[model samples]
Target: MSQADHRSPQDHEHTVHYDGPSGGWGSLRGIARIFGKEWATPAALETLARQNKPKGFMCVSCSWAKPADYHTFEFCENGAKATLWELTTLRCTPDFFAQHTVVELLTWNDYDLEQQGRLTHPLRYDPESDKYQPCSWEEAFHAIGAELRRLDPTSVIFYSSGRASLETSYLYALFARAYGNNNLPDSSNMCHETTSVALKKVIGAGVGTVVFDDLKNCDAMFFFGQNTGSNSPRFLHPLQDAAKRGVPIVTFNPVREKGLIAFTNPQNPAEMLTGSETPISTQYHQVRLGGDIAVMLGICKHVFAADDAAKAEGKRVLDVPFIEQHTQGFGDFEAKVRGTSWSEIEAKSGLSQGAIERAAEIYVKADRVIGVYGMGLTQHVHGFENVAMFVNMLLLKGNIGRDGTGISPVRGHSNVQGQRTVGISEKPELVPLDKIAEQFGFDPPRDKGMNTVEACEGILSGKVKAFFGLGGNFVRAIPEREAMERAWRKMDLTVQIATKLNRSHLVNGRTAYLLPCRGRTEQDMQASGPQAVSMEDTFSCIQGSIGLRKPASEHLKSEVDIVASLAEATLPPNPRLKWREWVDNYALIRDLIAQTYPDEFHDFNERMFTPGGFYRGNAARERIWKTTSGKAEFTVPDTLDAAGFDDAPGRYRLLTMRSNDQFNTTIYGFSDRLRGIEGTRQVLLMNPDDIAKAGLQEGQMVSLISDAQDGIHREAGPLKVTPFSLPAGCVGSYYPEMNPLMPLSHHDQQSKTPAAKSIAVRLKI
Candidate 1:
């Protein structure tokens, strides 16, 4: 029997997914977990082995978008498993829903809620029937249009997921704009808005300041909170190249990622047979979660001191020649670093003076350095500050606008970068606004729109009326799932542009429509014959992708077509964005992008022919940073708060994380062997000493509850307890399950990203 048959209401509590070791620390267990314990279920492995036959297809969810020249098991374990999970013999067909009401589906666990398989047809909720009945795509579109026709254009908000292609995202923005709405709430709001916001303030462009080729020449790397080995294995090749070149890469996080220590590329024959792993981190330091600011300051102080000592000893320092020529605000920044005390740094960072100095020594000795960050840096209350501090360090050594030294924000999704280029943003400069207004003939609104936080508050207060999700499951992915659901119900209408049924689909509005669209793995045929979608990589390179798989359903339309249909339905008789022309020829969409963002994509057609990808403009490399002063400026940090902590007695600060086999909201399997977790998704990690102090034993049942019932969604009961060497006051669990426990209020002030790393909760036994 499947898991759904046995679970009770409490089973939907915080999910505890596991990632077994395949080649990392738990390599033996990982292998055993996949090949031994899971051997009985060989459907996914079989599907991958079958598809391993030289299909020149690029992965849709990650940055490994190269021409598939050698497709021999080229897919990682997680990617393969995801493919298997997709091609599963299991089917969540129309018959399955015939018996289950939308309310019943809401009560269903997320795992089983979705594993019902690819949606076979479009669906809509009938209040009288209480069940989701099948509907045609055309009917569903009309239903959405009729409801949308009733409201003011600005009343509706558009939410996007990273899964959309440039063509689709561009079409989405066009549809929403034509309908007169500018509130584009997206997954970016929940993850990297801080990086974008901070970069826009300092560098003028809100994108990574470095490229893929830059990794080869870097002399040292400062990486924080990103577990590249598991989340996205493609990054390992470049990191390994840096390691072999003797470049020291330092890591600072609350928990040691097994992949960060040593990772073996499954592609290397020598590594595969001998099990030889490439050593990654030269220096690994564990800092308390949310202590990123102190840790960064400590590094800056040491670097500044090293420069002073070098000058005192009459040694050459700073490419000082370059520093004076290219940067500004050094004197003030140096004064702040020097005036800062090591005691304060140590206290706030939970690190000793010795460790901080060692990190600084590495930073100073390297001729060129790169600072790489991920969600951990962006998912805190002070995330914007953390990103700004990283830029500050790059400026100190005149390390930017060059080949090796800069800041790289390793984005989690494939097209989040492309979406920005396609105009999926609430904060756009006047140039694009004017250009679009000229092209479409509707004077665009220049006023800033609502971000994720503002959107949530607006929904709760009955300011925003309707919610339109382009592709993401926002209700589940947003901060504080419970509150979001309540806010969702207050809306006049909620529409989901989706592929399959998910928990968010059950979150019905006065009227809800689930419009099925083509998946990333399938072909997208448009009016101009079969079309290829484009996406930009972490390096700001735009490349085209042509999905090879047959679509899950024949009636499903591409997201581009759906957007166009919606545009035709809601616009003032004659639309402004020329949605008709853009959808007819996606090439026209590219031409518009080229004209709108001229500095980046000058001639989109010329670049469209190359599948390798097109690189965006580099401000640092041009030494033409667009800050107000026309030079790189270092901003001062906030005053120290050394003794301040967010937890109380029995109340642990919770961090919601992912496993090896998972993406942002997709589950491939139910195990995380690398961390030694098994059987269930309700487990929590803590310090062994802390567990003992609480009189808790291994495998003991317990419950975790937030101080207030206002936002927490977890119905977790007493669960088997597990202990690891996590920070004394912190606890860790997987997301979607943990999403309920976190609130929209507990977020980085500037970014509004959920503080998944620091939330106060109590344990019950």
Candidate 2:
């Protein structure tokens, strides 16, 4: 074994993470309560409600479940009460805010903070009144417009939250540009921007290549760094279907989540009656943090060897015909794989040759296979390279845009992809921008601006003057909380177009405004009629969505209206820009979108009604890729030098993650039900041997400080130690809480996603 192998198991002797929280002495009891908590599974019912029942409302969180499966009482544990809290007949009117100061309200926890109920009108923070005073929409827009006009265009940043509908997102971008700024710092910039940056560059498509139907046809499936059971429960049905059909599901993650192993289909009445759950992954690999790329490389190497062996035997090999016709750079990629040493592969991946070979056998035996990966695959230092490795494996078997064998980058938000499709990007291509400019009759600024992180950084430096958001808690989502808060204070105007209140509304710029927008579950009626917006699923299939619930407040306007009013208030009068008419009709937006990208959006209205959804960007259909050479290119990552991080004194690797109930930076209380964690996000998960080696007993409190060469120090304070079965030496903790420990600089070189998996830290007592 290589020397790198020597330190990991020994390191494991020191730390580990759990699927749930367990406390000192009372862990058994705490765990039992969680298991017995009777948190009824409502995902199946909720999904069913959206379709068969025709409620038109959809959960803003997950996407795998069919809308027809939605139920009226249906609510997942995470979905429950909170949805009511946001969508209920509750109200937080201007009068309510008249009693509370902005400073006074800051003391409330997020749940307690927003459970104060929903906003009923437009509000502006009044320092004089020491409270948020109700303001007229026109009044607020003018105040914000004046503030925006006073600043350099580059000084203004525009952010889009994922859950915002396509209509809203398009207007948000339009107004930001008409207001003269392109700093589109959005939710994608935080969550799966890595996937977009990686996959688009790798396979010529930014979104996942597979559709929902693709799941049923795959011969072999991989669950890479994804916990489908809780994070996306609707996927449990497909996983069960795939597993029962005898297709193997292989998983590689730091922890062994039960959902990946066996999942009870809340949809399967017989299975629920018998307490029988279908098993997903035939095999699971607990890859150490930062170890996925190596595991992937090893898989690619095995595929290379398998193809060679089949060639020697003169047998019809795994997708050789597909590879030859559809993919490029296979020869160079194969050579690179062949040159990789077995010793290095096993040592770096923390896997045995036996395990890798077993996986390789499974892959080779399958004719049609799909690889499903999550943040775990894309949130690393070499994230793009990691994605390339995944694509390389598919190309070896020719799995591009096929029935089942394709790449699925499991998305975290319901409509993050849709936001991008409808022009929410900071960097709009010249072609699209030119068309938009022609329609609006304004010379659109073509500056490539800052993303989310860069926006925070720019704001901190006072380069950013104002921030306008369609929806989202910006200060909470961006990394380095301290820097983000500090930067936000410098903004001249901060606007939040949202459904409910979040901490970010409180991240007050010099002048702040909150304009509530209708949600996915709320009705949107415009002059044209009741309008429905479309969202792209993880499968790259675009489908339409309409809402059924009444607006939380009668005053709430659709996101389209908010953008149109803002644009009118900001831009000089131009007959070319018909703001009122555009907001009144969404079909015009679709027409403009189709005009901007005829290749992708041609006859956009014709396809929007198809409940089956529309196919996007058909590189697979033509077997012609749009990469550098019009073919998928083979990329070889330089060997990463571990000596710099490992040789340091008193240092270990730290990985930041999330609990199932939580979404993004929104902390849904302090319990990780699936992993059995409760009461705190401050615990450090470690292996048994690592506990002893660190001279730390289970539940011991310790601080963690970073020792990276990059000159950033990470603080993991007062972490409670718990032992779990994870591979040794790597430590795990939940995110946002863990964000401070991962420096903004420690990101994927290509995608700029924080190498959230491979942070180095010094344990403290």
Candidate 3:
């Protein structure tokens, strides 16, 4: 029976369609509501004005590249929310913790836990009393240090979030290695590890090659599995300008995202005065979930066929000479494309041959193209293959290593890319350990450290005894929530350096400490004077960020100070590495960074203050491939279906997504304004056809059961079914909430990123 047959007439009565453009009055209203709720003080307004400006702090939101040209206000709607969220007057003081026990706080949702407000002081979790008590910084550090000394460094996990500065990340990594291990698992493991893993092997650089100028001057821009509206709205401005200039902006995703369709720039007076919105995407293709690899194969097939025809007519299509000189494995890739059947391509991609040809035509005609993607292509079993295939498609036309061309992976956190560059990675080879050892007077650990998945597995099995987080809710962000939370308490020590209270603090271990630290929007005073820290954006531009406002709490220390002090407390004093001097003056840390990575950070301090920062300079842009073959390589996928899910009769491919009101695991609000969802987040979006096929009614309550081959039974319950425009076999739900359904083992074989985007599931009433 169809869902419509069982549905009542009032099922969609409360549903209100959002017909306006992405950034019109809707975004203004969103900004205003956040200000009004947070009681926007003059201080908050001043911080917002200074955001993304020269000599001011970067937005603590998405890692979109800053423009060379400055704007009157560079902050977006979500960026404003992130700033206000940090600048709020509400405080989660010791008294607040004293009133609510950890047991009681565990029942609260993620939004409520963070909404309780910023952490004001260092706190120690008392398991016997079931409450967090105020503790001196010295006491907290000494106890944490003692615990670290008692445990094996190999069993300790030092997890970092992308919100930290480059200097801080460098010191954090140094501390871990100094303590005798490289067990550094960070935020990148969850989102874009596939981009790093795939691109590094093929192009010799893990990060995107495109800069702001390349994106601005590109002849055409193609996006896959990215939602510019929610994740990084600042990118929409460039897309809006490109649309006005008649550039071809193409998008491929299951959901017709509002951001990719049209945008009304709130900063423009003319756009605000008129209700008109500039069209963003010239062509939008709703590619099936996990079908990106198949779609790429089909496009390549069409391109090869077109080139063959062109050769017969004495014309050229593919850049044959460029391919021969700059790339390897093209012949093998072409063979793989030709071997794939049209019927298989059509079935897997869920697109007709004509549609695939149209996309290929766009690629063939455009002289310079920039490819943009996000976690959607990276959070699957075959995620590494998905990224490699995209690069292969671009290589055919020589779309990389030229002006106005290259791949741009839209990073999530402000400094996520920078964190990796500064050496917050599990792989020791990615950084210059020999230089670090010489400069620091210690032999750094050469062994590969634990990534996020391995760290979680270690914790679950009671092998990892200590957890130290620099700035994130680690327990809540990773997969296997129930299992991790239960096992988390059994650990020996848990330490979180954060700006606010979170569910991670509530899920305390035997000995836990919550250390409050200064945020990006607040001034960080040191023994020297007002200081600035450097951060690298999505495009590898390393810029200085100096906070100008008073901190929310005077007791809060800078991340640099906290890390240095903790290192002092833990490790025996090393005369060669002056931890205190580094904290007192950040320039010392910058100097050491320059010494450690002479190639990348040479003259780091001098160029950091340059307007819009200086580019770190990607090797790939100069056609200097760092791969073993000394040239860019084309990779062939073993299978067209990346996820390799079974075609069971009652299964649907589920892709976890984020709401407009959320960033990573931080829930700003319950409303997802772009999709017209409000008041609650416990809802599932599915195609109307799929809803009918499942015999489910619109707004019907249902539970999702995982179809993973693992023996573990995982399920996420009581989600309201909402009919939406998705593929017949695909469904969408918010992430972290749906993270429970993802098993720890269900990750990419190469990158080990959680396969959150392509989980096979069955819905039950």
The residue-by-residue lDDT of candidate 1 on 1-765, one tens digit each, is 123211211222232222322364343334334444233245435444433222233455665434323334556555554454544445566788789888778887766766776677777878788877888777877778888889887778888888788888877876677667678867888888888888877766688878767788889999887877567666776777777878888888776675666677666778777767767788777777777788888888887778778989898546676668766777887788889888888877878899888888888888889989888788877787888888888777777788887888888777887787778888746238888877777766666667788888888788888888887678878766786787787788888887667888888788888787777666677778777677787778777756656677787788888888887766667544677777777788788777777888888867754644668777766778777777776777774421124546677767778876567787645766556565567778776767888988867888877754464445444556877656667777787677776666877777677777676678877
lDDT on C-alpha atoms for all candidate structures: 0.72, 0.69, 0.88
Report the Cα lDDT for residue 709, model 2. Answer: 61
Ranking by lDDT: 3, 1, 2
Candidates sorted on TM-score, descending = 3, 1, 2
lDDT of 2: 0.69
Error of 3 at 607 (Å): 1.2
The residue-level lDDT of candidate 2 at 207 comes to 77
Scanning candidate 3 in windows of ten residues, the lowest lDDT window is: 1-10
Candidate 3's residue-wise lDDT over 357-470, tens digit each? 877788878889999999889998999999999999889889899999999899999998999998899998898998888888899999999999999999999999999999
lDDT tens string, model 2, 1-765? 123321234233333323221111122233233333323233323432554123244457654433333434333444432343345455678887878787777777565565556678999887677677788898988987777677788888878877776666777777777777678767777767888887777777777777777777888897678877556655666677787888888788777775676666544457555656555678887776766667777877777777678778897555767666666777777677788888887777777877788777788788887888887777776777777777877777777767777888888776787778878887766227877877778877788878876776777778878888777777766566766776676677888887767778877877888897776666789898887776666666666777766677888888888888888888789897778987788888877777766877788878865555666765743455767767765566565221114534566777777775466766545657667666777788777867788888898888887767677555757888888666667777777666666666667776566676677777878
Give TM per candidate: 0.91, 0.90, 0.97
Superior candidate under TM-score, 2 versus 3: 3
TM value for model 2 = 0.90
Error of 2 at 703 (Å): 2.8
